[model samples]
Target: MKIRVHVSLKPGVLDPQGRAVHHALEGLGFEGVEDVRVGRSIELDVADNTSDAALTDMCEKLLANTVIENYRIEKVG
Candidate 1:
């Protein structure tokens, strides 16, 4: 089976990359841009029988920074 993890900074954390993108967009005349955020996507392949708990453990331990970031997992295939 295949899975994907999406990791993102928490609400209160500052995202410099997001800000840079927003600024670049404005410079290109893209108006009405309110806010921006940056995140990451990780794809994994595992046995079909892999348990949800094990996947959660992977996210909590390595895929995401639990202190400042949140993670969401999706079973892709």
Candidate 2:
């Protein structure tokens, strides 16, 4: 089995890196560049028998920082 985890900043949090990227894109003359937000995706290959509770624990323990970001986990074959 495979697991895909997406970690992103909360809506109200400020993302300087993302803002910088957005400015750079505009400087490059890219039109319609509304907003940019940076995030991370983690892919895990684990046993098919892995439980949802364990996956949630992994996200809470290591995969994401709960103070500033939110995470979503998806399982794929």
Candidate 3:
């Protein structure tokens, strides 16, 4: 099975990297960008029998910080 994990910073947390990208875009004459928030996506291939609970555990334990970030899981195949 294929799985995907989307990880992002929680609201109210400052995203310095995202801000840097936004600034760079503006400098490059790319306007109209109101705001920018950066995140990451993780893809995994695992046994078909892998339980959702196990995936959640993986996210909670290692994939996501859980303190300043949130994660969403999708079973791709």
Candidate 4:
């Protein structure tokens, strides 16, 4: 099975990388970009029988920092 994990900073957290990209876009003449938030996508190939609970455990344990970030697990195949 194919899986995807989308990790992003939780609301109210400052995103310096995202801010830099937003500033760069404005400098390059891209208008109306009010804000930006950077996130990561992780893809994995696991056994077809892998359960959702196992995937959630992975995210909670190591894939994402639950204190400052949130993660969504997606089954791609």
Candidate 2: residue 18 Cα off by (Å): 0.6
Q: Point out the higher-scoring one by lDDT: 2 or 3.
A: 3
lDDT of 3 by residue, 25-70 (tens): 9999998999999999999999999999999999999999999999
How many clashes in each structure? Answer: 0, 0, 0, 0
Local distance difference test values of all predictions, in order: 0.97, 0.96, 0.97, 0.97
Give candidate 4 misplaced runs (Cα > 4 Å).
none
Query: CA lDDT of 38 in candidate 2?
Result: 99
Which pairs, if any, clash in model 4? none
Highest-TM-score candidate: 3
lDDT of 2 by residue, 1-77 (tens): 99999999999999999999999999999999999999999999989889999999999999999999999998767
- Worst ten-residue run, lDDT, model 3? 44-53
TM-score head-to-head 2 vs 3, winner = 3
Question: What would you estimate as the lDDT of candidate 1?
Answer: 0.97
- TM-scores, all candidates, are 0.94, 0.95, 0.98, 0.96
Lowest lDDT block of 10, candidate 2: 68-77
lDDT string, candidate 1, 1-77, tens digits: 99999999999899999999999999999999999999999999999999999999999999999999999999998
